[model samples]
Target chain A: MSPKDLEDRLVLAIKRAETQLPDDVVSALEKAHEIEEGSAKVQIEAILLNIKVSRETGAPMCQDTGIQTFFIEAGADFPYLGKLENIITDAVKRASSEVPLRPNTVNPFTGKNPGNNVGRYVPYITWDIVKGEECTIHLMPKGGGSENMCALNMMSPGRGIKGLKRIVVDHIVSCEGKPCPPTVVGVGVGGGADLSLKLGKRSLLRDVGIRHPEPHIAELEEELLELINESGVGPMGVGGKTTALDVHIEYAHRHPASFPIGIAVQCWADRRATVKITKDGRVEVI
Target chain B: MATVKLNTPFDKKDIQNLKVGDTVYITGKMFTARDECHLKMLELHKEGKDIPFKPGDMALFHCGPVVQKKDGEWRIVSAGPTTSIRMEIFEDEFLKTFETRMIIGKGGMADRTLAALEEVGAVYVHYTGGAGALAAKAIKKVTDVYWLDELGVPEAAWILDVEEFGPLTVTMDAHGNSLYVDLRKEIEKNLEKIHAKIENS
Candidate 1:
């Protein structure tokens, strides 16, 4: 496939991610709305309306279009491997103006906005290479409100899984409305600080109700979801039965000395989409 | 809870009567200000220079919007509220100095802002987080913009004309009540129970 073709598809994926709330997230929200009453219900109603409006208008669901992040699962033998980074960068620049994404990238020290989403190390891409003949790209436009609530903790290994649960609950409860509950709490366990956070954010890419393949991890996810909802920081934290739509946990092997936990919170918008490209050059965006 | 429709240049009595949890929809003029704008506004005040608009007569929105310019006119594509607590440091002073009557943002603010709302006869209102398209629908026009070049678009102050612009719930009111504070306490109690359960399990 021509680089332009791939870029165009990438832009389409970004537009889809920005304007449309995915089915799983929308369905979960609908379920929450059903169970909530009073002010909590009002907030969910507004969110549903907002989702509808954005879908109809083709405008971004949120003003903070967020740091454009892409996750790539690339085939080692796929063609155009060397050019993928540049093509993706160009696509982000085009999408910034074409989709009219908010110019979210800023120079930390100078505070200069490029006026396009692209900046140094921005349009942040995470790559995973596997033995396949197809490549898949996922776009997750993470808003600032929830991004600010991300936390990382390095704990003594002796504290165990109970310590991990306490840390997660404490972090979520303290953040309260700040991360824009009913949020999706993504927990990354066992990796180093950065890897743990990355895994935590990666966990958010999973569909709302899907459980981990491992029974133990899935149980932990369910338990954390219930515990978080027990906080009653419903909707935008106005107090209700549903503090979180779901909790997703991803783990990696940890060193005997350290147990690092990374918490990544995603707001109700949960904006994401995927684009798949086969080696045969067939492009599909979902 | 009661739903109230308020016009800008709000009367003190109207602000005072609003209790925490009361829903509000605002009409007339409001200005968008995020972190940079707040710092700039305060800097302008320190320099004894007048800001382009009268903040005293407008609702201050904690927003960094996505705007577009076409045919020599500005249009708001998405204008949802940014988190309000980021502005908590400057809000009390902003209220005292500017006498701004209402604040619209996502995520309720902290103690200083809650106290300032009571003292200044103002209220902190929360728009639904991430509801940018719905927010843009309420904005009628972009009347003026300040510091577009200096602060850049998102951080610039966008003076907008809006009509019935919310489902803005009053989370912090002029009557010394704050729903955020109450929610925090509730969550703290729940956390204790959850921790205990985690330990037992």
Candidate 2:
């Protein structure tokens, strides 16, 4: 395929991600709106309305457009292997200036320069090699409110199942309204620090109300959801019955001595969009 | 008159008179500053340079907006409020120096901010955080901008003429009652009941 064709596909893909709200995120917001009651109900209604206005008006759902991170699945035979990285970086810079996305990136140590993609591991592009002729990209704009609530705990293996539940639920309860509930609770279990954290964030990509394929993990998801909602963290941390819209868990093998669990909470605005590029250079935005 | 008239050190009686859902059309010169701008404003005040726009009788919005230039001027694209808790640390001293009476932001702050509001005769208004474009439309004109060269658009405060600018909700009144504090307490109580069940189970 010609480089022009490839660049055109890339640009369209970025714009499509910007303009469209992903089905999963929209459905999650709708479900969150339906289940909420009382003042929480009002909050959700307003939130939904705000989202509608944002969509119709072509403004970002939140002022903090957040760090533009991409998770990519690419085929080994992908036409533009070396160029995709620069294409993605260029897309981010263009989006930051054009989409008028907030320049959220700030330097850590110096406390100066707004490089515009400056979080710890920001504009984070996670890549996976797949056996296919197509390249797919998932765009997730992770905001600061929910990102602030992310944490990890070193639990004893002896504490086992019950201890794990307590740690997850307790942290959600403590955060209350700060993370901007109702939230999707992503729990990472049995991995080392970095892996566990990735697992936690990866869990958020799951569809709302969808349970894990594994019965055991699914059960844990349910129990945690029930426990978290019971906390009354409610919509925007107001008084109500439902604090969490859903709970997702992902796990990995770890050292026998270590039981590292990471929690990444996402706010009600959970914005995500995806796009696929064909070998022929046609772009499909999902 | 080109300017809107407002007074400083607003009293409880004045605050009580103000409703939660009141439309405010502000004209008197107000500073547009958020996190970084506020820090610089403080430094300017410390050095005894004439601070931009007197804080008394002026409004400050906790916003970092999307701005663009047209015909040799900058304009707001989406200038909605940001979460105010991040500013909770600087509010006490800032309010005193700025002598502010109205703070517009989303969500709410802690008791300390409420106390500071009471002392400063200021009220906290909750703007819809995500409705940036809608909010930006209300601002009629960009009169001036401060700290533009060094700090970039998000940090610099843009002075503007705002008309019917707000249907802002008052989350904290000057008398010291805060909706967020009460709401959080209620949520905590309900949380305990849920934990009790989990423990018993």
Candidate 3:
């Protein structure tokens, strides 16, 4: 496939992710709207209206527009293995202007903005190689308010499952409305600090309604979901029945001495989109 | 549940009249400033140099907006309220320096900001978070922008002309009362009780 075509395709995908709340996110908001009352309900109305206007106008769902991050799954023998990074970066820079994304990337020490949203280590990409001829890319625009609530806990091996529950609940309690509830929480267990946080954020990429496939993990997700909602932090943290829309967990092997848990969070917008490219050079955005 | 309209450069009477949970629709001038802008303002204050714009009855919004330049003119595409807690340390000094009467942001602020509200006769309004488009709808014009080169788009101080911009709730009032503090206390108290019950069970 030509570089321009791939770059244009990625740009389109980023714009979609920025403006539209996927069906699953919208459906969840609808359900929450129906059951919510008082100030919580009022907040939801504003959110729903914001979504409607943003979608219709192709404006961003939120002002932050978040830092753009991509997860790529490329076939082991995929062509253009070397060019994928440049293609994504070029598309991101284009999107920053064409889609008018808020140029959020900054030089941490110097506080410099390149203005095109591309900087050192920006448009962060996570990659995986698989046995296939097609490459898939997922774009998630994560707002900073929610991202700041992310936490990693390295507990003694003795804490076990019960300790995990305690830490997760405490984290939510402390977060309160700061992260913009009803958030979708992603919990990663057992990995080292960085991996755990990455896994936690990766969990947010899952389909909204899907729980962990394992029985034990799924049960924990369900229980954590209920417990978070019951905290009464509600919509936008004012107070409501939906403090959290869902909780997902992903794990990796860890050192026997450390029981690390990471919590990654997404605000109600939870904007994301996926695009798949075939070796035949066709690009399909899902 | 009460609805009220306020113009910029609020009088003491206007600010003192508000209470927690009061719905406020603000019009006239409200400037957008965030962490970086606040720091710059404070630096100017230290240097004893006059900052741009008029003060008094002024309201500042904690936001970093998605702004684009078209034909050399800036337009606001999104301007949602950002979390205010991050600015708690700087807010008191800012309120004092800018003579700001109100602060509009997403999450509520901490003790320092609440104290600033009490001392400075200002209020903190919690604009519904994530309603960037609706907020942009109320903006009549991007009157001016400053520090674009220094702080970038989101952090730059974008002076705006907004009208009837609202769905803002007065979570902190000038009368030494804060709904956020009260609610947080209640939640923490409830949490302890729940924890105790769990332990007993």
RMSD values, in order shown: 1.4, 4.3, 2.1
lDDT of 2 by residue, B158-181 (tens): 886676664466667777877777
Q: What is the iRMS for every candidate structure? A: 1.0, 2.9, 1.7
lDDT of 1 at A5: 96
Off by over 4 Å in 2: A1-19, A31-42, A111-122, B1-14, B18-31, B163-167
DockQ, Cα level, model 2:
0.36
CAPRI-style docking class of model 3 based on DockQ: medium
lDDT (C-alpha, whole model) for all candidates: 0.90, 0.73, 0.86
For model 3 chain A, give the 10-residue run with minimal summed lDDT: A223-232
Candidates sorted by lDDT, descending order?
A: 1, 3, 2
Superior by TM-score: candidate 1 or candidate 2: 1
The candidate that wins on lDDT is 1
The digit string of per-residue lDDT tens for model 3 on B106-196 reads: 8788888888888888999888888898899888899888888787777888898899998888888898887777777767776676565
Q: Model 2, A167-277: lDDT tens per residue? A: 999899888676777788899887698888888988887777889999999998998898887776676665566678889999999899999999998877677767678
**Pairs of residues at least 3 apart in sequence or in different chains that clash in candidate 1:** A181-A235
For lDDT, candidate 2 versus 3, the one ahead is: 3
lDDT winner between candidates 1 and 3: 1
